[model samples]
Target: MTRKTKPSTAAAVQMPLKEAEAGKETNCDEDKPSDHPKERDNNVKDNDGTKPAAEWKLPRKKALLQFRCKLEDAIRGDYLLGRSYWSLSRLSRENMSSASSQPLPLMDIRLWGVPLLPSKGHEGTDYVLTKFLKARNYKVGEAFEMLQETLWWRRQHRVDETTGEAPLGPDELVLRTMYVRSVDREGRPLCYHVYGALEDREVYKRALGTKERVEEFKSWAVQFMERVARRLSFKDGGVDSVVQITDLKNMRSRSAKEARGVLRSTFLMVQDHYPELVHRHIILNVPLWYYTFHLLLLRLLHQSDKSKFILARPAKVTKTLLKFIDPEDLPVEYGGLLRENDEEFSNLDKVSEVFVGGNTTKSIRIPIAEAGSTVVWDLTVVGWDVSYKEEFMPEDEGSYRVTLNRSKKLRESVRNSYYINEPGELVITVRNPTFKKKRVLYRTKFKPTVPMYVFFKS
Candidate 1:
């Protein structure tokens, strides 16, 4: 008998010869002559040897297709047109071209004359651009135009330099009523506005009479925003958003009416230039009439903007304030742990004299006997409005420069303390531009130290 041929170990694990020859079956387990022992060991380790095949998770075909389609739609629709009512020509073509090739390019963002890009450190350009796009319904051209117009407005008004210059004489009222006092839990600057504190409405109205006054108001508003931005730009744990508290505790009908114009103008300016700056707004002690005004304001704001506003009555003011601010950082008057005797809150109302009436001017001159001394003043006004100007006229022929030029209205108070570098006369002037008579009260004292210590007893 002929010697029986034995099948090789590899042939037993492979497909039958007839099936392999016909190419109708593949033997995945069959070892090739070119395969190395190391490769085989890796395969065996991956499959655990006893198992015939390795486990694999295949993606769902339908789900993958759906995801791809949605992604394409997002890029072609939202990113390109921003749900705009009007269609753009080049953007449409670019969108069509991007569908077959690469991703769409974002529009160029510029401030003043410099181009800006979004990066890990700074997202300001992207932030401002997205706001404009949303405001214009994602029409790239219109959004760009809107952004350009705002930039031009800022440049024409020279908003960046407003902080260094003397505030318009009328803005003193705003300074007294609206101011940034402290920081919140997130380190964002906390701005406080006490609408109820306004004692006279007619004074504010008279102060806001001319176009120049209105422009000045806007400039000061922008300057405040710039100051906030500078704070945010600091490297030491700065925040980009601001927390605003508007207290309407004693707001009257006449005061509300007078404030409407100023409020409207400020709202529009904020919406246009400083987008995404206010992270939260707490409106405290809101009266029933305020809801009507709120509704009107809602018409001017985007839907996204509405969510940032929080309304609270006097009873719930503390609870609402505690949400975004720490008790330690909040002022004592606002139900926080900080004391009224703290440096930030102390002597805010330490006024000495009070005047009432209009169309009058007053001047006071104090001759400084010694150089390098300090002059401290506590001044306030009641009834109408007044303009304040101070100058240091040297004994010699040195030119006198205006140190303070601010206007005040209603019952706001101002405290000014400055040091004299040279021998000069401190000339103070207060003028009432309105026809109505207003009361003025002021007190001053000379100090022998570099930093004045008028309030402290030795």
Candidate 2:
């Protein structure tokens, strides 16, 4: 008879799954409508006594686009992409709700259980995922604890370079192993087993050098794991506690296929064995996407010893960098400081341009049928937005000049703030503030559908 262990401290027992699926608004895979001013602000009372939620609703096209954009931003900001351990693509309303709600403690009965889905044949009533195991009077807690202990053992596996034998922990601990075979002098392959143990000083590589040594290692490994399992009240049901096989021979023959099979099996197995724990830890697996840009900057800064650049006043450096890149040919394109007669700028001519606003030009125009709805335009430029989300630039007089088209100037001058929906032609001129003879012009034809946000870093 198995001696049952008490409930696991790591598993929660009481939070029902129903509360995890609420507060979710399902989308039909269609674009969400854009909001009017009041709607965008959650229909709050406007300071100017504008329209209320009952009086304002967003346009279908605008809402859809905005939602799509926000979703995209969320994905990008979170770095939910390739090789991420967290499967953001697997996110659902239930998962999102479960994360937001107050979670129960480990002692709660709901911790080891999962709320059954309506379609899961528990129609009209909620069921715990582990209820079936409970009905069989099996000590699920013991099984769970044993699994955790096994993983902990695996995680702690290490060996000393000099020890030829496995070392034991202070207490009895479980271990796993595999068996493999080798070829004999007659060219006949003889089978042997190998052991993967925690703190096993005898590394398998040296032990498996000969067929006889290999068999000896495998025999010891199987016996060791079996001993641990028996001590933990675990029985070797039918399958072998460990497998024996030649590693290099098998791996080389089917690398790709084996890898795919292992990946698929591991994911499903993890979900089956520890669904709740897996869900909570999934976010940790996600790649830190936003850090990529920051990392790149830091790397470049280190490589160039540009530490002083990052320390400069944000406002000064920000504007300078902005004006530098705001041109058709980036300031960097001029290749740092230029000779008085560089061939690159030989064909370039300076032109007279007016600067009314800051570095950003308000040349785009987007018309809205309603006065309250928010308007935005899409500019495909990568990492060009003025939002602080991007790297900081310097603020300088000679760095960059922004000009607005005549129409946009008229609008912003009258309204103080201009909103555009479509792109309009605008010219940006960069000149040598002192020499004033060497200059470059950048023409932007892209417009933004979203409200453009500009900030001074300093």
Candidate 1 per-residue lDDT, tens place, 375-435, comes to 7765544432467777777887855665665544433455577787778787777788888
Question: What would you estimate as the lDDT of candidate 2?
Answer: 0.25
RMSD of each: 23.0, 27.1
28-118 in candidate 2: lDDT tens per residue? Answer: 1222221111111122221123442123233422332232233233233443122221332243233434443322222121111111121
The regions of model 1 sitting more than 4 angstroms off are: 1-143, 167-172, 201-206, 209-215, 234-238, 340-458
Best by lDDT: 1
Rate residue 297 of model 2 by lDDT: 41
Error in Å for residue 315 of model 2: 45
lDDT of 2 at 16: 18
RMSD from true fold, candidate 1: 23.0
Query: TM-scores of the models, in the given order?
Result: 0.46, 0.16
Winner by TM-score: 1
